[model samples]
Target: MNGTPIRLRELAPDGGGQLSKAEQIAQLRAQLAELDGGAAQEQIGGEGVVPLGGELANVLPNGGLPRRQVTQVSDTPSLIVEILRQVTEAGGYVGVVGWPELSYAELSAQALRRTVAVPEPGLDAVHAAGVLAEGLDVVVLHARSEIQFTPAQARPLLARVRAGGAAMLCVNVAVPSPALRMSADIARFHGIGRGRGCIAGIDLEVSAHAKGWKRPPALLTLGSATGGVTRLKAVPS
Candidate 1:
């Protein structure tokens, strides 16, 4: 049900010097909605990650981070690091879903405007989706929250994006809608091994998942922006 209507009389005490039954219900609904983050999630898809459109073109295969759904990455929070950076840099507010799982302060460097951390991570993903739908540029769900699959939950967001009407970005750590898949434009996944005292090398793997992106995912070693990301290797489909 939608949030309970808050009527005028509820704002005051009754003859008994206490809120009436209806008022009590209203207050309860109000609190519940606030706690739930404002809305409910709709269901849509199934598992297996696929790339989305080219938004992060320079960083991933589909040229874009997965939109309207959860994006699962294996290591280093590489996808989140770059995608959120891109989102905030483009002038947007970013929300972190799983607070404990991320080094938020270190990540805040990416936000151009402001970053709002969700106070509680205990809410289910459907509830989380409701809160996200209210208003947010980006919401990153780490491996903390309880997420589920519902068709209506994700479809509207996709519709909003396709219509260019919604200015929100939502991320999940669990599975996503089966109809929804994101292609990487130029995503970089980097791993480096070194002794506790010595610096070895950073291995960077890049992928292009766009339909027009003929280039395969590449793996390279790094040095710096100019000289790093060297030794590109294509990934065979």
Candidate 2:
């Protein structure tokens, strides 16, 4: 014939007309990897863990926060600031939703400069978080007493965080289901005198539990003075 040849469908390895299940899975994985930016995927710190620094790292099972995951923090503002401190110090951008009263003076100038604040509540707050997740490396949503998220509402926001390779910190807000839950209780005050001396520092008994961590709850001592995290230590159960 003088005409160009027609292409035929490729045959399966086992001589079947369709690909094998294993082959299909492999192909899907390859496609997903490509969509994920290829084999040399980027991680927050090459290990996918954002270091919390010093003793704070010792408390978490992975020695740091896992990027692209939700970490719910109880109503401890100082602790939240500590988490943000490490991320910002590493040259990451931070977005705060519905937390307007955050003391800027406690944060480093660079950290303050990198922070994006959205002090609104309700749906607007959630929308703000979703928008920030698109471009920020870390997003903190302060639910306070006004906002609570159901699984349906939280899934899309979390998906955005994962797709953007950002970490999410939910303050005073219960996540639909979180990978990690951290809470703090005031243990004692270090520098406060009866009624004369100014308040100096307070000792916080912090504990963390995660979904896959087999170890008992991680107990830690977090000390804050002058609105700053000054010390961290691992406490034996």
Tell me the spans in candidate 1 whose CA falls farther than 4 Å from its real position: 1-62, 66-76, 105-113, 145-173, 176-201, 206-215, 218-237
Model 1 lDDT, full chain set: 0.40
For residue 142, model 1's alpha carbon misses the true position, in angstroms, by: 2.1
lDDT of 2: 0.62
lDDT of each: 0.40, 0.62
Residue 4 of model 2: what lDDT? 16
Highest TM-score among the candidates is held by which one? Answer: 2
lDDT of 1 at 37: 51
List the candidates' TM-scores in order: 0.47, 0.71
Lowest summed-lDDT stretch of 10 residues in model 1? 42-51
Instruction: Name the TM-score of candidate 1.
Output: 0.47
In angstroms, the error of model 2 at 32 is: 27
lDDT of 2 at 79: 72
